[model samples]
Target chain A: MSRHTIALAQINPALGDLERNLAVHEKTAEEAIARGARLVVFPELSLTGYFLKDIVSSVALPLTSPFLGRLRDLSRRIDLIVGLVEETPERLFYNAAIYLSLGEIIHVHRKVYLPTYGIFDEQRYLAEGGRIRTFRSGIGRSAILICEDMWHPSAACVASLDGMDVLISPSSSPGRGGLEEGKTFANARAWETINRAYAQLFTCYVLYANRVGYEDGACFWGGSEVIAPSGDTVAKAEYVSEAILVADIDHAEVRRARMANPLLRDERIDVTLQELERIKREGAR
Target chain B: MIDLSLNCDLLRRVLIGFIVNEVRKAGFSRVVVGLSGGVDSSLSAFLGAEALGAENVWALLMPYRTSSPESQEHAELVVKQLGIQSDVIEITPMVDAYFERFPEADQVRRGNKMARERMTILFDHSAKLKALVLGTSNKTELLLGYGTLYGDMASAINPLGDLYKTQVRQLARHMGVPEAIVQKAPSADLWAGQTDEGELGFTYEQVDQILYLMVDRRYELSDLLEAGFDERFVRAAFAKVQASQYKRRLPLIAKVSSRTIDRDFRYPRDWGK
Candidate 1:
């Protein structure tokens, strides 16, 4: 499927209300399927809303959860990448994203970075994820990064090196700072820059799905977008509202961009690893 | 002065979304706001009327006997302009009835009593009408603790809580609030000839600048002084913010268990909604 339609489900999940959010997911996924989309992506914590605080334990679901089973069934019609709070048998909670295809969970990426600064308290309630890997999906070879994880370049670098053709970011970022040019938020503009830079540098399609609506007093600005490997935004959603943005992406473009730039091809991973090791050893002294 | 200007156009959409989404999430479609004819309350009323249709918004004009007649007039102006449902309930009788027993009650005491009385009426109406009380306190008053605890400070949600007084004026003008209310000197109007700046002993313009630096930007006292801010004024402004911290928080509950409310039992207010 070189050329396929993808949908960004930019929804506002009700805080701690899983049933209502599931209903929203079902409705949005049905619409995406009806629109001839092969895959639909939701924002971080799409199943359980962001700012879960002490209620994280109550909303945390094991991999065997029927909630996820419903999404897995929905994926039989259209592939899904949904964010949720994952609970291990050991009872540790993580901010996780699951890729469902063919009625099976294809890949699960536990968010490696837990932001604990300024309005974010994820570190206080959840354990840190320690893995970053790319996996095969219905679209192409893809990697998942939760909100704060994408802020770190090393995470995206690892995904690119691991041979990801598409970098999907699910974010529940709050709108802050000030408005830029009387329209977009400064923070939202910053995210756009980051997404475009990663798409151009990695020569991969960037699929950014951000949530909208108010949680407590913080408003999550949903400017979900799809950027091509050439650093061009193919489709963008409106801010502070729910939207299902759809865009047709061709893997041939990723091949063409990579052939033209060839930056990822010349990357020296051995040199980077050696330098990082040397720095760690020297700093230990 | 530091430019506290905001993009009122963008801010209007964000705040309107907040009012509409939050009220619906809390399972209500109607909201009641106590219209004081001041910029903050009037701006909130305008947003509420625009967010949830004017018919869903209820404006209550609760004026004390000593409140300026223009205050009532401006509040009525908002009601008529928005075509919202409104009722004028004079707080004079309720206030005077309580002060009758305590003849020696000072002006501050009387003012506090009136504020709490209005809160009582607002809450009572909230229950009767099944509407949420929209708060009108701005960031300047919240940071300076320039409001009565459990009085005008009480609300189910506050759309103006994050905006400073200067920003509130900018938004008020953008939202087409009457120029008279927007330009009027801000006053609690608990008594005659009383203004907020007069009681604070400084202009909101100066204090808002200081607060923007001290609180929002996290500027050190030394940095503020080096920025040419008067040392005395900066210190006093910081002190007021520190001293009034309690009014901005919920009542303290002494912890007796493993997980106490607010300390560890921290579920969001929108829990399960």
Candidate 2:
């Protein structure tokens, strides 16, 4: 059984101040490494804060952008997953997560779901991603899902089908709604429900890292956590406070839960693909 | 059975933290709240004091001539209980002097004048004390457009804007606010016996339940009707929310250019702060 210790760096990112945000990432990463974490994950857009409308284009960077070199260098000792606005050569932007390991960029996952409703306006500023895949990292086979992508079950399904041992979901969701007992925020409740369900259904360890602090009027609730494969919340950070949560994940449990549930084994992808294609062809007519 | 219950301990910490951070971020350390002796204003005072210490939170009691005497007593009770600095300013002279020219001024005009007059006093003292005026309007009053424009609607920040009236009452109980103020009939106290719900033609408890479903839960008109709301009441409530849309937004700018303020050119209010 391979055991990996992960850190959720739930730090507050100041809007449009790239220098300050980078400093925060460096400081938090150092702290996580001191705590014996092998893999560290940050919230969505950890480099640039959420609610960046016009500033999205101003702060967008490519994979080779020099600003990310600091993080790439830090990954030499410990692997890190950090979120930022990715700009293409043609000038399109994406809410993206870059996975760095051993002083190099290994994978980049652009957010597939751009939520436009309520407080979110990502659709106005970002291009949607088209791909979802799991890749080999220093910590083994891992999949990365940016903020809203986790809300869509297909993104998780695709990742699970790709044979992932662990799922990393980075988010910048705001605290909202009336308070309920055992849950201080409504959005937090939704997050708990979905993450637990995903862990149990996919039979994989789930790592969720949410940002904290206020941007404009929206308050990001930073209750980041790691969930076990049996739908149990193994560790959770404090709400509305910036703190790094470290938890040791047992990779053997993924195999244990998968054998017990056999949910992934029973999936019928060929039938699903054929039916989806047929529906698309016939419904368009 | 509406899920209006709150974890008051957590709410207190977050709200106080929010107030302190927001105020400090904006380069202010103190706050001013109008003490109306109502659940809304009293709750704002408590939050302000909890956020920025008692010395930093100042209470202003601006009473008109026809204002209820019990209102003044209750306001005093909050001030004494919180051990915060307070002053009583009589708004009757300013309002009477203005209304003398218009003998035909009705209750609406008089009420608007009183509200605006009280706000003027609050702002003047806010400048003197170097504090920002904390708003006291709740979500129900804001959605219904029950507040006067450019009057009590203006503030540096509003902590209670998201909580409904009933929820405010629930929170008031949790915050240890005086039960006398919480149980009393909610009144703007513009005239001798003006009550908020009496003029609105519906109880706050009833309206808050409907709003919880319609606004928060995103229930449709039919859904509200199915949930036992009267047809006429639902229609009126929905109409008010739609009609008061302008109150919830920035003033409309007539755009001659490609990018105008509040149109194509928009930025967060706390952009630099």
Candidate 3:
């Protein structure tokens, strides 16, 4: 079956304004679905601002929170993915993302990798996520990973193990020098290597959505895109701003790319696992 | 001690030459400079070539998709005139993807990102060539807080930093920048057709004049206002310089019962040298 329209919402969200942020998300989602898209996505931490800091604990909400309930209600029309900060019983915060569809809160993914250096201090405020899971969507089995999660090989590899169709990444990355060029190189590597590597291997589509605007003096460069299974950026946004982007997915391309690459059957899992184990050991050190 | 030995004339070149020497001694044979096709980077590319040699200086042309053709053309003309190795690559695919996801990003954030993207290219190629990144900002930009921190603002070495806007123009002319680029309005060329003067709400003529009287001649605000500057521009210029003063100085020290880095531990860029 051909996967239908997926909408990208580059919403201009105001920080700490829960009502306004939700309104922006709803407005953009409405715009996307009005155009006949089955899926609409927002940036990571779209609920609470990226630089919420200690304010995160106060604003952290559960999947059943009324704000989410509103989004869940809208899922009756089309699938919606909204980013929010979640708090746990032990008092650890998570940069989390939720997937909603058919009036149901489908899946929740905590950010696996915590970025601690530079402008980010996620480790100080967030509990590390240890496992990767794929949440099912209208497009079929899909995985969700947060910003830093996509940076490391282990996280992307772990997400692929579940055999998902699309990897949904919601991120809040701040700006760095030569970021435009650097990110061009990084995303190509991220999409081509991971999407081509995993999607082609598993026959899945890959969706990456990121945030925009300044939070606590850090500029978030918005460059979200959807890569086909063949490792090509089918659709890309203009520059750092907010909007909803949509692209149709050809499910057959995923299968066809898989047939051609045949990467999964030829994978050196044992060697990869050994290298991962070494990495984990080194990280532990 | 803060090295006051460097006067305006030889300060930039001397500092750059010394840093280049140190970098070479530290085993770097080349340098990367992102030619934004702007005045600052133009001056930086010039000084970098002088210090590191044209062969060792690689100028990068990483223009976003929307970047004006003239800016790109000027960049091409610059490296060609300087006889340095240059590469032209578009950052549209790379940058637009980020915006594809987040559309409400303001000009400030985009400008910051553009600067950082240029820096990333410089650093990446610098690593490839075992070189260093040359910074292209001047004292006016650094002092007035008119830059993106860690974005266009970061560099391994800066030679034009101590020069004022007026000084750079003179030096650019003195250094023989093609009459075209030297005379072109100073713009970051971030958007389709943007100028630094338009964004700053003050012309370089006005700003340079204000800065000269204020910084070089150390004139007071009342004096400038009385001397015929728009009061608001004068106040904004003052506040801008004051607000971004932190961006110009070293990081603040906690002063744990002793002298601090800026106060006591201060030294030259080439202290050992």
Candidate 4:
């Protein structure tokens, strides 16, 4: 379908409380379904709260866990994207987002970048994912980039090259660098710019789901939004408040944008790959 | 000079949310603040009242015999303005009774004792009221180690810990803190005729800018000098921050085990909340 309604579940998940967070997810998904949403998106680490330093092991869940069964059942009614700490059978953990539809796991995108600088210690606890790939969802071809993955342009470039119609970014971004006039944080402004640039450049829909509420003095600013292929914000939630932001997106817009700009169509993947290989060989030397 | 201006409206919302979420997540509905009538404490009380309803916030006005009467009156002004529950618990007896045994104690020792006495009262009331002790120390005082460790520095949660003194005053003014309290010279009220600027040997404005450059901007000593900051003042301010480093942290434990308390036993304060 070209036209569909999407909901961004801008919720505040309880820290390390998997049961409570699961209930929240179920309730928010039911509300979105009632509101005529075809798909619901949640922020990164929606099941387990961000900054889960040592408690990461306790909250990690395998794909076969009952929690995924419950979410998979919920997705039968409305396609759902939920974030969790995925545990492999070998005991390795990754920050992952799973797409569920028709009571089945459509795709699981492990977070590629684990930020380890100021206010982030993800690399110390969770193993990083190795792949950047897109999958077909109920809506269209899509890719998931958890938080820091969107910060790197190459990740989005690969997703766009893989022919993704929607770039889904789930973030637990902390609000910082307070500006005086705009009533927005520095991180929010940067995210908005990135979302718009990616939408316009890749000629695709950009769905950004960011959580709200304070955790240990770091306040995650919600401001979840949807950007059209025209680089226009279709809908936006309030900052620092929990909200389920819904917006209508049409794939026809992506087709029209690509036809008008032709930026993605006139791309040079061969030249790009050749230059990257040359740069890698030089670095190895 | 680096611009220290903050979007007061956004900051007020963010701080109010922080207070509400941090308090409720920790499983508490009420908070008690040691109101000293200073801008920092007053701002904390105001934010606390706004975050958790006025009825949920309790302000304690603890004054010593030597403390200025205006301190109590100013604190009362805040109580009356916000209409939060308050009590005037004079620390004179608690502080003076202890000092009587050591009459030769200097002002700093007596002041520290009074601060601890107030802390004791706040904690006792925290137990009685089942409320968290809201901290009021601003970043400037915290970085300078100007606060009494384990005394005024002790609290469950602090919303103003990141704001500098100038930023505190800016926010206080924006929040409509009574002009008298906002414009008044900042003092710990530990002794009569003493002000923080007088004790620190420089203005908060000067030190706040220097600290912003040093701490926030991560400017080097050379960068500070290149930015036209006074060498001696910057050196002195940096020394104060270095000397009082211990006050800003928990007591260091000798690491004997593989997983030390602070070194490897890493967990956020809001774990499992």
Report i-RMS for every model.
1.9, 1.6, 19.3, 1.6
Whichever of 1 and 2 has more DockQ, that candidate is 1
Reference-based TM-score, model 2? 0.95
| Pick by DockQ: 2 or 4, better one | 4
List, residue by residue over A69-124, the lDDT tens digit for candidate 4. Answer: 88988988999999999999999999999999999988999999999988899999
Error of 3 at B192 (Å): 38
How close to the true structure is residue B206 of candidate 4, measured as C-alpha lDDT? 92
Chain A TM-score from candidate 1: 0.98
List the DockQ of the predictions in order: 0.63, 0.54, 0.02, 0.73
- Sorted on lDDT, best first, the list reads 4, 1, 2, 3
Model 4 misplacement above 4 A: A179-183
Total clashing pairs for each candidate: 0, 0, 35, 0
CA deviation > 4 Å runs, candidate 1:
A180-183
What is the C-alpha lDDT profile of model 2 across B1-273, one tens digit per residue?
477777777777777777887888788999999999999999999999988999999999999888989999999999999999999999988889998999899999999998999889889988898898999999999999999888899888888898889878888888889999999999989888789999999998888888889888999999988877799999998888899989888788788998888676756666545
Identify the runs in model 2 with alpha carbons over 4 angstroms from their true place.
none
Off by over 4 Å in 3: A179-203, A268-285, B1-273
Instruction: Give candidates' CA RMSD values in order.
Output: 1.4, 2.0, 21.5, 1.2
Candidate 4, what DockQ?
A: 0.73
B174-229 per-residue lDDT for model 4 (tens digits): 88789999999999999999899999999999999999889977899999999999
Candidates 3 and 4, the one with greater lDDT: 4
TM-score for candidate 4, please give it: 0.98
User: With candidate 1 superimposed using the best TM-score fit, by how many Å does residue A15's alpha carbon deviate from the native?
Assistant: 1.3
Global Cα lDDT for candidate 1? 0.93
TM-score of chain A of each: 0.98, 0.97, 0.88, 0.98
**What TM-score does chain B alone reach in each candidate, compared with the true chain B?**
0.99, 0.97, 0.84, 0.99
